[model samples]
Target: MIITSAKLFEEILAILKDEDNIFVIGCNVCAAKLRTGGEPEVLEMCRRLEESGKHVVGWTLPTAACSIRSFESLVEKNEKINEAFCILVMGCGSGVSSVANVAEVPVYGSNDTLSLGGSSGGKLLSEQCVMCGNCTIGEFGGLCPKAQCPKGLLNGPCGGAVDGKCEVARVNDCVWTLIYERLKKIKRLDLLYVIHAPQEHGFK
Candidate 1:
């Protein structure tokens, strides 16, 4: 998901202030969950921009703006989408790139996609999955040491483990403990005794 900042939004507004007609396109899939560009967000932005005296030509949210096929259909149905002087994209960086590929008009951004993470609570989420391709959970009892460990260490217990809890947060469960349970369930508890050496993994 992408992260949006107030400064970024102000800068975007400054750029489009001169334009009369503008289109604010949002993505419903990842961007929505990420709190970046969903349909509701696009509408809120439209209202604010209209208040600023810019004419909002049209606004719509696509299921997955990054997909070429989905965006193609959205563009076909929303003919007035291109009628605007500029387009503001509310998806990740890939969405902006895809929109630019299919349109000749100027494109803008409404958020910054940092990394993939899930929601923690109401209007709040955190970076849990770092998207490190080299996964050792299968060998580590399926507990994802990279994500569960407080230090994200590949080796066994770190100094941060305190009384079976992580030093970072007392409420947080130990990653190794989770690993042990998962390993035991799969009859691979013996694998926990073996230490895994860190190795570089490259993205495809």
Candidate 2:
């Protein structure tokens, strides 16, 4: 899932300093799961804005704010959205961009978009992928070195790998070591002999 966190209230206030009539939009999916955006978040933001003496023209919680079609449908249903002087998006970067693409008024983000992550534990999200386009997890026994290794190394337990731990991030296990162990357990140790080419860089 795409992780997100609310932007500081001070930062949001600064961005909306010149605007009065604000429309808030939230995502019902990823952002909601992260507690950064959703119906409750949208209502809370509206309350905050109103308490600050700013007008909240309307608010919406789109099923998937990042989806163009979903955003379009929201816009169609929320006529008050057009009455606002500006829009505050309480979702990820993608959701903000989606709203900006079709919004008549200027769009501003109220959340900081973070990496692709999954729940590591209760209310804790840990990044799992960097979306490098070229996936090589199969060779590494499904472990992503790009995400697990601090250096984003493709072929390594770098020279700094020690005692199955990463030298850069001393607390975490070396991803390469995990990969090696997993491969050994699966009897696919020969795959380690195969050298992977450098990842091709550029837009996917």
Candidate 3:
């Protein structure tokens, strides 16, 4: 899931400073899971806008605000959206961009997209992937050093690793240590000798 956090109230107010009639759009998938751009959030935003003396024309919770097709469909069905001078999207960056691409009025985001993460527990989000366009977990026993390691080391732990903990972030376990333990447990230590070429920096 794409993790997100609501933008500061003051920041949102500044963005809508010139706009009186506002329409809100929220995502029902990732953002909803994060509780940043869900139905309740949209309603709360409406209340806040009304409190600020701005007229909220309407609000919608689309199935997937990041999906252009879903957003376009919602816009087609909601003619009342046209009454608003601008739109406030309470989803990720992709969702905000999707709305801006198809909306005639100006569109602004009310949330800041953080990372590709999974729900750890409650409101805690754990980042799981960096989308590096390469998959090397098969050889590393499913632990991604690129994402887990602060240095994005692919081969092994940096010299700074201490006592099975990452040097960059002492609170986190050293990804290379985890990788070595897993490989040893599975009798795949031989794979460690195989050196990988540097990742291609260009587009995949």
Candidate 4:
């Protein structure tokens, strides 16, 4: 799912101002987990818009924003939303598109579409994997050295590997150390002794 921010709020407000009846729709699945949109955010925005004299017809949160199956529940619950001049989407791009597809109404996004990721903590979106379509774990012993290492080191610990921690960031565990441990666990530590010669400058 895509991420969203407050910058997209302006675009949403601009499109929704003239609309008399508005339905603020939130998604409980990806959008909720990512802290971008959910019931709380939807209700808050609904109240604010209603206070500003806009006729906020109603609000609803579908369990799965991308699933049209659960969207049936929205019809039974939020019948007033049909009166809405426009539907406000408090979810990612996919969720917004899905809602628009099912509702058959004008959908306005309340958030910007960012890359796919997960939240490690409260509102902290950490990019764990890049999905580069390339694998290099054979040389690195199964650990993602490119992502976990301080400097994305692949060959070995650079000028930094102090006491099994990264020299660049003391709090970070050295990727080489993880690789070494993994190799030892699999009885492949002997592979570490194999020297890797520097490559020539030729394009080949």
Segments in model 2 whose C-alpha atoms lie over 4 Å from true places: 70-72, 120-125, 161-165, 201-204
lDDT values, one for every candidate: 0.72, 0.84, 0.84, 0.71
**In the order shown, what is each candidate's alpha-carbon RMSD?**
4.0, 2.5, 2.5, 6.1
Can you list the residue pairs that collide in candidate 2?
Answer: none
Q: What is the total number of backbone clashes in candidate 3? A: 0
Model 3, CA-based lDDT: 0.84
| Arranged by TM-score, best first | 2, 3, 1, 4
Per-residue lDDT of 149-199 in model 1, one digit per residue for the tens?
656777766666677787776887777766667777889878867776665
Q: Report the lDDT tens digits of candidate 3 across residue range 1-204.
A: 888999988899998999988999989999898889999999999999899988999988888888867445866757668788899999999999998888888999999887787765565545567787867768778777777888877777787888998898999888889889999999999978888777777313
Clashing pairs in 4: none
lDDT of 3 at 142: 73
Model 2 scores worst on lDDT over the 10 consecutive residues at 195-204
List candidate 4 segments past 4 Å from native: 120-125, 130-204
Q: Relative to the unseen true structure, what is the C-alpha lDDT of residue 114 in candidate 3, on a scale of 0 to 100?
A: 79
lDDT of 4 by residue, 124-164 (tens): 44333344456555766767655566566556878577798
